[model samples]
Target: MRLSELANPSRFNALAERLLPWLVVATVLAFALGLYQALFVAPDDYQQGATVKIMFIHVPSAWLGMLGWALMAVAALGTLVWRHPLADVAMKTAAPIGAAFTLICLVTGSLWGRPTWGTYWVWDARLTSVLILFLMYLGVIALWRTVEDPSRAARAAAILTLVGAVNLPIIKFSVDWWNTLHQPASVLRLGGSTIYPTILTPLLITAIAFTLLFVTLHLMAMRNEILRRRVRTLRLMRAAAANP
Candidate 1:
C-alpha cells in the first residue's frame, strides 16, 4: 500500500489493536526477566556495589527519552510534509510518554549521582541537555492543549517538535562534545563496551522492555485521542442537522 493509504487512522488503529496485545505480553516478559537478571543475577560493581544496579533502569529511561523525541520529530515531519492523518496523533500521544521517561531519567540519575558523584545534581552538559529535552516536551504538550482548533494545534505542535529536534543531537553528543562529570559512552562508542556481560545483558534487555512499553502506551493514547475527535465531530454534525 501507498504511504498515504497506510496513514489512515482506522487502518493504523486496526494494526495497533492487532499488535498491542503481543507487544504488551512481550513487554511484561522482557521486564520480568530483565529485572530478575539485573537485581539477582548481575554481579555488583567493584566500585559502586549495589548502586550500580540502578543502571538497568536509568540508562534505558535515558535512551528512551531521546528515542521518543526522535519518533515525535519524524511524526511531525510526516504531518507537515505528507499530511499524514495519523501523524498528529502519533506526536500528541508521544509527548506525555517522552516527558515521563525524561523525568524518570532525571530522578534516577540523581539517585545514581548521589552515591557516585557525591552530589545529587550537577550542571554537566549531558545532564543539562536532558533537562532541556524534558522542558521541550512539556512545551509541546502545553501548546497542543492551548489551541482550540485541532488542525492548527497539530501544525503548531509539529513546528515546535521539529524545532526542538535540534536538541536531540546535542543531548546525544554532550558526553563526547564536552568534558563532564557524567561518564562517556560505553555501549555506543567506536570501541567495544566497557561493561561486563553480567551487567550489559540485563541493561540491554531492560532497554528493549522500555522501548516496547513506550510503543504500547503511545498506541493506546492515540486510540483515545482518535475516539475523542470522532465524538466531537459527531456532536458537531448533530448540532448542524438539528439547526437545519
Candidate 2:
C-alpha cells in the first residue's frame, strides 16, 4: 500500500489493534531480559565499577532521544511535502516522547557522572549539542500548541522541526570533532565495538526495548489524535446542520 493509504485512520486503528498486544508482550519480555542482564549477568566495569551499570538505561535513552527527533523530522518532511494525513500526527505525538527520553538521558548521565567524572554538569561539546536538541523538541511542541488552526500549526511545526535538524548532526559528531570529557564512540567506533559481549548484549537488548516502546507509545498517541480530529469534525457537522 502507498504511504498515504497507510495514513488512513481506520487502517491505522486496525493495525494498532492487532499489533499493540504483541508489542506490549514483546516489550515486557525484552525489558525483563535486558534488566536482568544489565543488573545481574554483566560484570562491573574495571574502572567505573557499579556506575557503569547506568549505561544500560542511559545509553539506550540517549540513542532513542536522537532517533525520535530524527523520526519527527522525517514525519515533518512528509507532512510538508506530501501532505500525508498521519505525518503531522506522528510528529506531534513524537515530541513529548523524545523530550522525555532526552530528559531521562540527561538526568541519568548526571547521576552517572557524579561518581565517575566528579561533576554533574559540563559544557562539553556533546552535552551542549544534546541540550540544544532537547530545546528544539520543546520549541516544536510549543509552536504546534500556540497555533490555532490545524494546518497552520502543522506547517509551522514542520518548519521548526526542519530548521532544528542541524542539531542532530552536531550531537552525533560533537564527541569526535571536539575535545570533550565524554568518551568517544565505542559501540559505533571504527573496526568494531570495543565492548565485551556480556555488556554489549544487554545494551543492545535495552536499545531494542526502548525502540519498541517508542513505537507503541507513538502509535497510541497518533490514534488519540485521529479520534480527536474525528470528534471535532463530527461536532462541526452537527453545528452546520443545526444552523442550516
Candidate 3:
C-alpha cells in the first residue's frame, strides 16, 4: 500500500494489528539469540577485558537513542506537512522510548568508561551532546503534556523536534570534531570496520534485536494511543448529547 493510503487511521490500525504479533515474535527471538552470542560467543577485548562486554548493550542503546529521534523527525514532518493520521501518534509514543534508550546509553557508557577512561563521566563533546539529546526528548514529552489540545501540542512538538535535530550530527561526529575521551567511529568508518569479525558479529546481531524491540514497542504504544483517542472522542460525544 502507498504512504497516503496508510495515513487513514482505520487502515493504519488494521495494519498494526496484523503486524504486531509478528513483531513481538521477531523481537523476542532476536533478543534471545543476540544475547547468547554477545555473552558467550563474542571475544573479549584485549585492553578493556570483560568490561568491553557492555558494548553489546551500550552501543545498541546509543544507536536507538539517535534512531528514535530520527524517526520522530520524520513523523514530525508528516504532521506538519502531510498531516498524516499516524504521525502525531508516532511522535508522542517515541519520546519515552527514546528517553529510556538515551538513559541506558549514558549509564552503560559510564560503566564502560570508568575502567577504560579511569572516569565515570566527563564534559566530553560526544557525551555532552548525547546528554542534550536526552534532555530534548524530555522537552518534547513535556511539550506534549503541557498543551491541552492534541493538534496544537503536535505542531509545537514538531517544531521543537526539527530544531533539536541539529544535535544528531554533532552527536555522531563529536569524537572527530574534538579531542575527546570517547573513541572515534570504528565500526562505521569510511574505509571499513576496525572491529574483529567475531566481536562484530554479535554487535550486529544485538543491534538488530534492539531495533526490532524498538519497532515492536512503538507499534504497541501507537495502538494504545489510538484507543485512548477513541475513548476521549466517545466521552466528548456523550457529554454533548447529554447537554443537547
Return the top candidate by lDDT. Answer: 3
Error of 3 at 209 (Å): 0.1
Query: On residues 113-222, what C-alpha lDDT tens digit does candidate 1 reach at each position?
Result: 99999999989899999999999999999999899778899999999999999999898899899989999889887878999998999999999999999988998999
After TM-score superposition, the amount by which residue 235's alpha carbon in candidate 2 deviates from its true location, in angstroms, is 2.6
lDDT of 3 at 50: 80
| Per-model RMSD to reference | 1.3, 1.2, 0.9
Ranking by lDDT: 3, 1, 2
Give per-candidate clash totals.
Answer: 0, 0, 0
Select the stronger candidate by TM-score from 1 and 3: 3
C-alpha positional error of residue 197 in candidate 1 after TM-score superposition, expressed in Å: 1.1
Give lDDT tens digits, candidate 2, residues 43-106.
9999999899999999999999999889999989988998988889899999999999999999
- The TM-score leader among the candidates is 3
Instruction: Write model 3 residue lDDT over 1-244, tens digit each, in one string.
Output: 9988987777888999999999999999999999999998888899888887899999999999999999999999999998888899999999999999999999999999999999999999999999999999999999999997888999999999999999999999999999999999988889999999999999999999999999999988998888888888999999999999
Total residue pair clashes for candidate 1: 0
> Candidate 3, 2: how far from true, in Å?
2.3
Worst lDDT run of 10 residues, candidate 1, spans: 1-10
